[model samples]
Target: MAGKTHDFLMVSKSILPEAILKTAKVKELLAQGEVYTIHEAVELVGLSRSAYYKYKDGVFPFYEASRERIITISLLLENKAGVLSHVLNFIASVKGNVLTINQGIPLQGVANVSISIETAGMADTPENLLAGLGEISGVRKIEVIGQT
Candidate 1:
């Protein structure tokens, strides 16, 4: 880190929408090893580095914005049979189109999973989507880590 630092926010820094906040979060996660590196990070967010960097510190997308969004959800789950299946069923029940799902091998009864989904045709709003997922058994933590 050097030079006169600049925040990457593109949209006004008022009440940020959900998408930008979600994307910035991805950047943070990548930095913190919560997620991985650049290519994965941008892909996870469905944003070009240009767009992501543009709003990395500023704009955000919301549940309302999620209607047009393709976002990735990261989960920390208990390593148990039917856990991932149940999660997928919940996502499908809400009409979330599964884009990609990546899961690391279980370690110490826990597995970290990253799933990307398109919200365009979802029957429920993103907030409701999250709530539904939260209710499922074995799903410990969920975060909309990226969106565009």
Candidate 2:
């Protein structure tokens, strides 16, 4: 599944067109049990059934985008104590399940670290997780290396 992950972009709803926005709302209504069927959800949101189907698979809230996904992130960190520990703690704090971690030997005051995490139970989106990690001390660089 390493090469099968779809790329995603985070967009502001305020900048989206109405049909797309309505399609997302229809999905929310159905997912939250506010509506019984797709037909009902679409109707509640003033979206046509055809439009709902068109966008349903493509549009979702940020929290749902990474749901059930496994993502690999690569980081460059300073050769300092507790940097890796802090990274792991941050992942756990957001309920990200760390599946594997590979750390390279430090050279010239920096180390390359790759972490694969299961995001099914994470409380935040992958984008947010990356942003949070970038804020921690000793983090020199962060980027998503892969996903599935």
Candidate 3:
């Protein structure tokens, strides 16, 4: 016997079957905190609980599915007065939303800085952003530490 292999596809809403679309609505209701329980959400979306449960894990709106567009980058920066600010400014210029930043104490004239950013609205791809960061003065190194 052979094991099942699952494949995924991106389909436009115009052709999606009703059950899958209703499942997406249920998820949206929960995410927006508009409904408290599965039953309420399923009812609001005109879907049965069983159907919601069946398709919930498999069907998602494009935005919901791609919402995990966050990345954390670690940088080796010169312990200079404006190096960190420059890095932040560059990120803003590229439309990257900065979520968190952590900087370690300077050691040997260098500091370790980690920045987490949401890249959904970024004008450049992750690689392009990294390349731009590398071009900034005093940014010694740049590498992606995490992504989700």
Candidate 4:
């Protein structure tokens, strides 16, 4: 059979601004060393270079209120030297600024620790942070004992 077909298709989908949808692309470029300069990242993201520069410091996903509430988190960790440090690291990773730490002597292979965190500048909500802490290995228990 000798036949030829030519068809034109119309695709109607609205495309929004790439920068507004996926801001991480620009960040990934910087992280992976794919883009060395802001000029390059802005062009890659199809956003105005000036806009990228102006909003880089302020555009964040998690919005936290500057309330006077300081969250007190209690963690039951395995009796290991690094376990407590690891929990602290996790808190820092989530941008939870540590205010104070109190740890009881290890008893029965576990240590009870209380950490007061200032999460005003953190991106993740306090609940999400607690959930992440609960997932940490060697953490037997995690509880938000106080929040105000």
Best by lDDT: 2
- What tens digits encode model 2's per-residue C-alpha lDDT throughout 1-148? 6779667876788899999999888878887899899888877778888887788789988657667989889999999999999999999999999999999999999999999999997888888999999999999999777767
Candidates 1 and 3 compared: the better one by lDDT is 3
lDDT of all predictions: 0.80, 0.89, 0.85, 0.72
Give the residue spans of candidate 3 off by over 4 A.
Answer: 1-68
Model 3 / residue 118 / CA error / Å: 0.2
Comparing 2 and 3 by lDDT, which wins? 2
Q: Give the range where candidate 1 is weakest over 10 consecutive residues by summed lDDT.
A: 5-14
Provide C-alpha RMSD values for all models, in order.
14.4, 4.9, 11.3, 16.3
Clashing pairs in 1: 9-58, 17-60, 17-61, 18-61, 18-62, 19-60, 19-61, 20-60, 20-61
Give one digit per residue, the lDDT tens place, for model 1 in 1-148.
5687544322443576655665766766676796667778877767667767776654333564567678899999999999999999999988899999999999999999999999998888888888889999999999877877
What lDDT score goes with residue 12 in model 4? 22
TM-score for each of the candidates: 0.60, 0.64, 0.55, 0.54
lDDT of 4 by residue, 119-142 (tens): 877867776887888887889998
| Candidate 1 stretches greater than 4 Å from native | 1-61
lDDT of 2: 0.89
Question: Quick one: ranking by TM-score, best first?
Answer: 2, 1, 3, 4
The collision pairs in model 4 are 69-148
lDDT per residue as tens, model 3, 60-88: 66444434488889999999999999999
**Regarding lDDT, does 2 or 4 come out ahead?**
2
